[model samples]
Target: MTFLKPVLKSILLTLLIAFTASLNAQTHSKNGMVVSSDKSSSAVGAAILKKGGNAIDAAIATAFSLAVTHPSAGNIGGGGFIVFMNSEGKTTTIDFREKAPLSATNDMYLDQEGKLIDGINHFSAKAIGVPGTVAGLFLAHEKYGKLPWKDLLQPAIDQAKNGFAFNWSLYNAANYFTKEGNTNPFMDSYFRNESGGVTQPDEIWKQTELAETLIRIRDKGRDGFYKGKTAKMIASFMKKNDGIITKKDLAKYEAIERQPIKGSYKGYDIYSMPPPSSGGVALVEMMNLMELADLKTMEFNSSEHLHLVAEAMRRAFADRAEHLGDPDFNLNIPLDKLTSKEFAKKRFQGIDMTRASVSDSTKYGRLYDGENTTHLSTMDKDGNAVSLTYTLEYSFGSQMGSKELGFIFNNEMGDFNPQPGITKSNGQIGTAPNLVEPEKRMLSSMTPTIVGKNGKPYLVIGSPGGRTIINTVFQTVLNVLEFEMPVNKAIEALKIHHQWLPDQIVYEKYLLSPDTKKSLEAKGHTLKERNNMGALMGITYDPEKKIFTGASDSSQPDSGAVGY
Candidate 1:
């Protein structure tokens, strides 16, 4: 039993790393940068940049490579957001986040008694959404890419076919799938070695089937996967497995070009995904509050700083729960006001610096609401920068896949509030701005963001940590833009998060000092310590010196950062 406990702990830690801040940081770089949760993926993106591809080209290439190398979070069977800023200082956001299948309904995850059904909303066939990565990549390339789309995808295709070194991230993900007593046909094919043992480090692991799939996508473009053979294969699997997805659902999925939600903190312009992605709005709200504080006078990790950040997180998250959802679904969200300086000041005044405001006291009549996600930040020599975050929604997503497609499907439907009107055990009456609806995208926490200073990209930041993604990106931005820390130190510093509900401040273990915790407790805040937080990969540019520094975070030591 004692041994089992350690095994279980290791298993959970592996899954946690698989999902969040649990990735390794294998750092390196010089001029332009590419930093991601996977070494091979980063390398591929860097190589693309060296080959004369622009930032969008590198980003698209990196995304596809991650689909093969870091399948746990980097995915094609899923969807995500991209924030791109070109040399002209023009920044655009591509919102390719997954949408609900037309066959889906608000109550699909509820039973006869209107109770929330767990498995059905999570790893079951009903959990899959109409995917958007293929469409998203194509559209981003059409608008901003330089290298041929086939050229961008070929690296990933060759890597999958010719094989790459089996790394620890993939090793742990494989363990997580197997140890958890779950089995997917795709997992069986993807994770296995010829001798039936776990694939070892330094050993070459190949995905011949996945390579073939990528080849098809390269040869045919968007129609390759969504409208033809791949579509038929997915529809057939759904039909046999009690899933509701149809060829029509796949055919209708389109990646949208959305205006970046813009904000400023201390002279740096922030550009992030809007609406369906609540990240930018929450970030703006928090930064607005931080802007009001005299954080410069306070020491890093001081109780005052923690209190300010926690309060901001609490308020912004509260606002997110109240007002955020798919903009196309909930049409009345105060998109402009909620992100305005005046609104942030109003929200800031409600916070009492001396005491913790629990969820029950958080108000919402005026407001709004808004990750198994992998993130990477790339910058080309031409000054074009990209901050992209993509995901399968959970570790290995629905733990389901189309046998013929060679990719896992996202269990994104779990993101929506099941039984939207149901009350939680907590006293706060929960809001359901993110409930499922036919063709409506589920709300996500992914905060793929870019910061511009003096009309040029100053920082590129994002992460994968489910509920923690927003705060992770938020704190990192503050570290650089406000505290004036270098890119490496900004990502390596201790981090904390408080997401309105739960009412407990989640601090990184051994990172938050005892004195700080004591002060927070005295301030009426409950505390919970966690071993990890999120894999925050970022790069910062010093325009004056023409220098760029990239960091993959200390949480995941093998995270690779490459530049040429």
Candidate 2:
């Protein structure tokens, strides 16, 4: 009886742990109207919807809250894109990609010997670009927002001022800040005290300066940051750090609305942002090429399926490096022709089904660009959907914070080609079409997409993984639309990515078995294991039931989904 009792106790403990893990991995919102990578932000957005706010308003509120709650990626210091779809099926794209400062020169990161300088393109003040998040969010609110702009900003301001529970991510953020060459005054002030002591994870992380900054923006509008003391402070920081951003650059920064790049897949319409975002064309072209294969007939995640998808990814990225760029800088982007079905068919025809293909630096047709970014999806009762993707370029965004403005800055200049078409001494080829020029928007791979049936949005998806953004979204959509998986399963499934340059297929380490690797390697693929790749967040709608189902990538511990 004693032995039996011990066995029973062991079974109970194991079952209890498994149940708890399942709960920790996901959240279900009875309402399903809002979802984000952070729980607090999701709650903020959901509350806005409950208060009669529309999708845009909810997204704005969520964005502001994230600046306080999810500081790693949610930011006011960087720039990104917005793809919005109204209930009537009308869609619009906002291009808020950061632009090089007027003083930026093409060879800013190149040495006198015409060689690329180490860390020059990503670190220090020189790498900074003009930010657009504030202007972009303001413009979005002014146009489609139902709630007052100040109302959207208030929650974030309160969160910053009052402080929230210090989380594991916030702990990691502090660790990163304390590392040598990773110091910043703005970040230090939050993590370290005026007495030069660091705070513990259990202590509060209040950002009084940031709260004040948000208050100014709330009261004075966009000009609060662009024209006032905030702008002067940013300029002074740049001058101190050897960065080139000037007050004039901040004053001139504006968020431009561009036409959404449209594509169709298996009878469903796909809408995403256009250049200088490489995501839209790449996603559209990849889907078109995917149509060439009968993916539905193949087993999901099988070597056969993965092989075909990886080939499509490689080809699309090759095209990205060759033909996609900022329209204002490169006038002949051929977006329409590139995303056309016929073009996809031609590209698809070039693939050898049984083996992998080789790719190199000289591969891009003429063109294109990657970044660390964040994403969220929102859907109100009205069926209006918004997929928002924003970034600070790197974690902690240049690892340097502004003491005065209380926000980090982006190392966005790294996205531009340092040299034109030539492989430098460092064995790197420059992307000419995406090269830096005065007022030129650098290339980006931030793809925020909406998938619909008969002009009504059924899915909203996006992710943050530098160049892996395209592949993550592609696989997530494929999982749901092709395999008919539920929204949560779609995000849970293992993802694989292949960019043409590396000629290697990187898969989540936990996803592939020895057999899977051997089978893929037999087909000539260079397989590599990675801890993880993408942070995909999604929301789906079931029209027949008129119900919304939202989810965030289970891999993100803090991800949240909340409805009514």
Candidate 3:
């Protein structure tokens, strides 16, 4: 009897753990709406929807909250891109990418020895670019938002003021910050207590300074951050840190509204961010090339289909590296040449049915030149939809925190090619087309996308990853349109990426079958295995039922959609 009792107790404990894990993995739902991300941020977004705000309003609120709650990823100190499709069938791209400081020269990072010092170039204030997140969000709200600016900013302000309970995920991310051996003195102060250690779950974390800053922004509008006290604090901090940002940089910064890059795939109109961001153009080119194949019939993740997608990514990336850059600075990009049917066919011709092509051998046609800055998508009851993505570059930007502002600055200048000889005709040095230039926006991989079927919005989606942005969004779109998988499953499925520089195709371990790898190896494709890939957020609208279904990536600890 005693032995039997012990066995029963063990079984009960195992069952309990399994059940709790399952519950954690599933999403918490609301009316007909869904918000997804790491914990508190998701909840904040859902609360906004419940408050009568539309998708854009909810997304804006969520963005600000994330800037506080998920400080590791979101911030007002960086820049990103937004792609939106309003109810009227119109689409636009808002470019708010960070610009280089005017004092920035092409070879600013080069030392007398001409060697690029890893930490010096990437971790200093000199590496910080002019932030555009505030301008981007403001532009979005002015155009498509239904809620008042103050109303949208209120949630985050409150959250920052009234401290929130830290969770295990936040604890883990903070731990990573320390483990990276590069913790900025400023972050160390906020993320730690008086003991100078990471805070654990259930601990109270309050961002009083940030709350006050948000309050000021709400009261003074975008001007609050750009030209007022907030700007002064940021500029002062830059000066102290030997950074080049000035009052003029902040006052002159503007988020430009541009047309979304458009393409068609299997009868659906696809819209994504345009140049300065290489994502939209690269994505469109990949889809155009893919249109030549009958992918709908191919088995999902089958070696053949997977290999083909990999090849397509490689070719597109080859072109991306060679010609894509900021349009304002580079010669007008031959958009026609890149997306033309003829160009697609010619690029596809390089792919051998039986094997993968070598990276250097994949050729793109004549090109003249060119290109997270996070994504949030919103749809109003009036049929207006917005897709916005914002970021601070790597986690916490340059990790240079402002004590007064209680925010981190972005290290986007590292994104520029620091090689000495890369220069532009305007005497701009280190300006590898995509390189840093004063007031010149840095290039990005953010690809916020909207797909419309039969002239109506169907899907609003995007992702976060330094260079994996395009491939993640591309694969998810195809999973729905070509593979016909439900949104949730498509997001959960394994992903593969090939960027051409590493000269290897990286795949999630779960996605690649031994047979598939062996077959690809036989075809001369270099294969690399990775555990996790990227995080994706997307919503698909069912025009027939007029219902919106949202799905967020499971790879992240917190991310799911809520529908009302």
Give candidate 1's TM-score: 0.92
- Please give the lDDT score for candidate 3: 0.75
Ranking by TM-score: 2, 1, 3
- TM-scores, in order shown? 0.92, 0.93, 0.90
What's the count of clashing pairs in each model shown? Answer: 25, 6, 27
Per residue, candidate 1 scores C-alpha lDDT tens digits across 305-424 of 898899899888777878899988898999798789998888777778798876753454242211467899999888899999888888888888865677888988787877766535
Model 3 TM-score relative to the real fold? 0.90
- Computed on alpha carbons, the lDDT of every model, listed in order, comes to 0.84, 0.83, 0.75
Give the Cα error of residue 463 in candidate 3, in Å.
Answer: 0.6
Best TM-score goes to which candidate? 2
In model 2, which residue pairs have backbone atoms overlapping below 3 Å? 32-563, 125-243, 322-364, 322-365, 322-366, 322-367
In model 3, the runs with Cα more than 4 Å from the true position are 1-34, 176-183, 193-197, 361-373, 420-431
